[model samples]
Target chain A: MKLGRLNHVGVATPSIERSVAIYRDRLGAEVVREPFDLPAQGVRVCFVDTPNSQIELIEPLGADSPILKFLERNPEGGQHHLCFEVSDIAQARDFFESGAVRILGPTRIGAHGTPIFFLHPKDMGGVLTEIMESPKQAH
Target chain B: MKLGRLNHVGVATPSIERSVAIYRDRLGAEVVREPFDLPAQGVRVCFVDTPNSQIELIEPLGADSPILKFLERNPEGGQHHLCFEVSDIAQARDFFESGAVRILGPTRIGAHGTPIFFLHPKDMGGVLTEIMESPKQAH
Candidate 1:
């Protein structure tokens, strides 16, 4: 599989507002989009654009939120995953599957409006990884 | 601190040779530099150059290597840190310190032969971040 650029680094946080302050006031980041809810994923997210990639701040939005357990383990939150773009999500998924890498779930529409799938941490050397469609367009 | 490009994402591993196989044979990475040891840091590292940034694979050289604890917690190894380039290391260090951010140690030469320092994870949203001088001239 051809690996593309680093799209974004997902940061799980208890509050997107607080994460925004750190990226903005402390890091001198000038652009931080307003936080929005992804009810489908049960999380609120905001993008902190960087020179090369971005930082995606995500906060649990519902009781069944996937990141709820992560927050329970790390109350102050932490890096949840690293996302990389793939020219074609399907092809990339096929490649990982062929290599016996475990993918978490079926490809779904991501926050970027692109099809994305998360690779299980165990199969990814202890780091949760997201593979997303490049030049993301509505899926 | 002026954030330059994402230099690389450091992944701690038990073996660089094994990680190289995954990147080269599976991920289709074309360039995988030879592994070298940094005695000062007590870790061996190698660079896998990507289009935009790079992936750094680090293996502990000794039992007391800082990464040993990480590998202990995750026998499979894990993402150790994210490194970003900075035009001036001292200036970036000053900015972080002024913001009450914790610096792990005095600036030291990094794997890239660049002056670098790790910011305390607690002050960096639970991500151990590295700030390094870019276009590193061998010191």
Candidate 2:
């Protein structure tokens, strides 16, 4: 699969507000998008834009949310996944399948409004990986 | 702290040889630096360059290595940390200190031969973060 760039590092957080402080007050970050809920994904997400990439802060929207389990494992929350861009989501998916690697599901419109799919953590050396369309602005 | 770029994502592995195939064969990575042991860090390390950043693969060097514990928790290996480049390591260290955040120690030479320091995971949203001097090739 042709990997494009490191788009963002997904950080699972118990509270996006607190996470914002770390990036803003601590790191002196200037640009942080407002937190928005993705009901379909069962999480509240926001983007902390940096020079090279983004820090994606994600908080569980409900008790049964997938992020809740991650939180349980790490109450302090942590780096949940690494997302890389790809020019072709379909080709990326096919490449994973051909290599006997598991893709979580069909590509769906992710928080960035871009085609995205997740690769199983087991297949990625225990690191959850996200493959997404590169440079998508929903234009 | 002036974050320069996402330099690399550190991945702890059981064996660099097995990890090489995942990057070279599966991900089509073209450039992978030779694996070398960092005795002081108690780990073997290598770099796999990507478009935006590189992947630093690290394996425990001996029984007493700190990574052995990480490997114990994650037998298949896992993402260890995220390293971001900083224009000035001293300024970054001061920034963290001014915020009452913990720094593992004073800056020391890292795998890249650049002055680097680690931020305690407890203070970094559960992600062990490395702040390093940007683009230092040690000429």
Candidate 3:
């Protein structure tokens, strides 16, 4: 359960293009990946690279999108979750379970193509948290 | 406004001590600052250090705390804002103003003892954002 870097902050956005504009045009961000769909995850995602971390702009893609409920609660969208890297996802999951922390679901391949699992907000200081294993290859 | 490092993600909490324990005992974070009150800001704060950025845990210190409304809505507390460093505070403020990105208030000294200002969530993709000058002396 050793904590590593703050990988990225997941931001739920109603429009990825508009969010990209804010990061690129308004914030003067130099690198922003084009929005791409992850059908399995039910979202379109764009990465806005900062000097040390990234802003993950996520827009719902389909009717059964996981973030649909969040968007319903916050029509304009907002910060969704915080993702942190761990050396090993298995150990992290085990630690959380042992400590009675609720894991939202099974570990799955995340947008980064690394194993990741979500922790319930109720167990994470009311903030949804994602624990991910550091990717072997640079992404 | 040129984006620098993702300085920190502010987390509003009901109890800084409980939040500190979650980061330390549960998340296995190695370094966490002792909670301290910032009377000027009307919140007690603590920092949970990650490798690249820190998590600022904030708790209301008095009746007139600015985050009182947010806490009322989310009684369990949650992520509050995202802070990014900028090289020049004056230029950053000007850029936001010229772009019609509402700045919440006059630039004031932040927890890091550097000039900082909050951006309206309406203009920031529904996420409250803090623009801060890179501190001359690291905190």
Candidate 4:
């Protein structure tokens, strides 16, 4: 697949508010958006934009949220996933198909109207990966 | 601190060679640098540069390596630390001090010739964060 760029970095946190504060107050990243709850995904997300990339803070709203479980097990926050911007989502899917990696979606519109697909972490040595195709809005 | 940009995303893995292939072959990130073994840290690192940020694949070379111990606990790879580039090394140190976050260094450079410091994960809600001054290469 033709990878465009590093779209954004997803950070799973126990509290989105706290994470947002750290990024904005301490790191100097501007808060681009407020927390938006997504019940289907069991998450409340906030976005911060930097010069080069965006920082996504994801907090689990329910006990069943995967991120909640993740925090329960590993409290230390680290890299969650690396998203690569692609020109064609279908072509990106095909590339993963050639490999043993499991595709989570063919294509789906994400937070900012960007098409994206998540690769199963099991296939990528436990690192969650996402391929996205869309023009990101400047915050 | 005045954050410049994200320097790189660090990934701890069992095999840098295999990880490098997956990132380069599947993800399409160009291999800008080769694997370099840091004997002092007991780990090997390979760097891939994308448009926005860098992907670093790290593998422990010895049992004493911190990566080895991390892998021992979290065999499944996930998010590691997120590093932010700072314009001034001393100012970056001051930020941490102002926040009462424990600082790991105001010391020597790593990988590239950039002065760096680490904020304890406990202070950042389990996230390992690094503040790095722009490298001399950019000067």
Candidate 5:
């Protein structure tokens, strides 16, 4: 149940293009990948690569997207969640459940194509947290 | 203006002790440093070290703390800001200014005893961002 590196900081945005522009033009981020759609996850995702970690910019793909509610609360969008890596997803789930930390749902494949689960904000000090299985690229 | 590593993610909390326990016990974080008070910055800070980056848990130290309003808005505390390392603080400040981005204040020595400046959330897509001079230990 040990936590690994922080994979990325999830940011919800109304427009991925606008967010990308700021990260690149304003912040001088050099490696911003093209935005792509993840229909299964209902998000259009773009990854801004920093030297050690990434900033994940996500926009709702459809009306039923999970992050739509978050955008509603923060109209201009903002930091949405923090994703931390764990070596084993099942073991992490067990640890969280045993500790009475509420899991949002069953573990499912996340945007990065790894098994992932979310912890409720109420159980995570009011910050939505995502536990992701360590990605191969990270190693 | 090369962007350095993601220095740390700043988390605002009502209680640093409570936040430390959750990171240590629930998340199995191995290195939860002792909480310390920064009277000048008006924050009680504790750092939760992840393998690649750190989580800065900050609690309001005084009534006049800058984060008090954020706490009032998000009573349970939440993800406060994302801090990234820069090779030169003054150069970074000029770059941000040249792009028409709003700098929160004059670059000043931060809690880490390094020059740092904050960006206006409104200018950065509703997310507060901190630019910190790369720390020596990171190298």
Candidate 6:
């Protein structure tokens, strides 16, 4: 698989509003985008930009949201996943297969219009790993 | 506090060598530094360079290491902390204090020569955050 770059780091939080304030007021990161509700995923997401990479703050909007259960177990805070920009999603899937890692999706368009797939946490140690087609606007 | 670019994202894993192979062979990240042991922290770290930030794969050197405990609970995989580079560690501590979040440390240098401090995970919704002075080479 041809890896392009580190896309963005997903952060799970109890409240997007609170996380936004902390990222902005404390960390000096600017809000690149406002919080958007993803009813399909049962969460709300906000993007913040630093000098290098973006931080995605996610808040569970429904009880059934996976992030909700994750927060319940962690309670403090934790990273959701590390997304890597890939040249080809299919090639990435093939690479994972060679390593015997389960691929969650072949290639699906996600929030940012990128074709992405997730490598099961069991294969990647404990962190959720993602491989996605490089964004046109990627640096 | 003047925010510098992100330095690295730390990931705890059972074996640094295995993680390194995946990152280097599959992700195309080059191993910029060899593994270094920090007895005080009970960790051995290897650094990989991404386009925007570095990835630090940490392995606990001893069974009593804090990372060992983390791996025991989160056997799947997860990020350890998000580290940001700052121009002044003291200023970063002051900035964190001005906010509602509690600071975990103040201007203490790490084994890597960067002065760092942590923000209490409670305020950040469980994400262990570190603010540090940019490494000499980074500056």
- DockQ, in order, for the candidates? 0.60, 0.66, 0.86, 0.61, 0.84, 0.61
Mark the regions of model 3 whose C-alpha exceeds 4 Å error after superposition: none
Q: Residue by residue across A80-134, what tens digits does model 5's lDDT show?
A: 9999999989999988888879999889998788999999988788789999999
- iRMS per model, in Å, is 1.7, 1.5, 0.9, 2.2, 0.9, 2.2
Q: Alpha carbon lDDT of residue A3, candidate 6?
A: 50
Q: For model 4, how does the per-residue alpha-carbon lDDT over A27-67 read when each residue is reduced to its tens digit?
A: 77754687798776677878778778787778877778868
TM-scores of the models, in the order given: 0.93, 0.93, 0.97, 0.90, 0.96, 0.90
Chain A structural similarity (TM-score) per candidate?
0.95, 0.94, 0.95, 0.84, 0.94, 0.88
Q: In angstroms, how far off is A106's CA in candidate 2?
A: 2.2
Runs in model 2 deviating more than 4 A are A136-139, B136-139
> In DockQ terms, which candidate is top?
3
Deviation of model 1 at B73, angstroms: 0.8
- For TM-score, candidate 1 versus 6, the one ahead is 1
Find the candidate with the highest TM-score and give its number.
3
Q: Predictions ranked by DockQ, top down?
A: 3, 5, 2, 4, 6, 1
Error of 2 at A6 (Å): 1.1
**How well does candidate 3 match the true structure in TM-score terms?**
0.97
For every candidate, C-alpha RMSD to the true structure in Å: 2.6, 2.2, 1.2, 2.3, 1.3, 2.3
Better of 2 and 6 by lDDT: 2
TM-score of 4: 0.90
Better of 2 and 3 by TM-score: 3
lDDT tens digits, residues B70-132, model 1?
898878767788887888888888898887788998899999888999988887777788888
- Please tell me how candidate 2 rates in CAPRI terms: medium
Model 6 deviation from the true structure expressed as Cα RMSD, one decimal place: 2.3
Candidate 1 TM-score versus the reference = 0.93
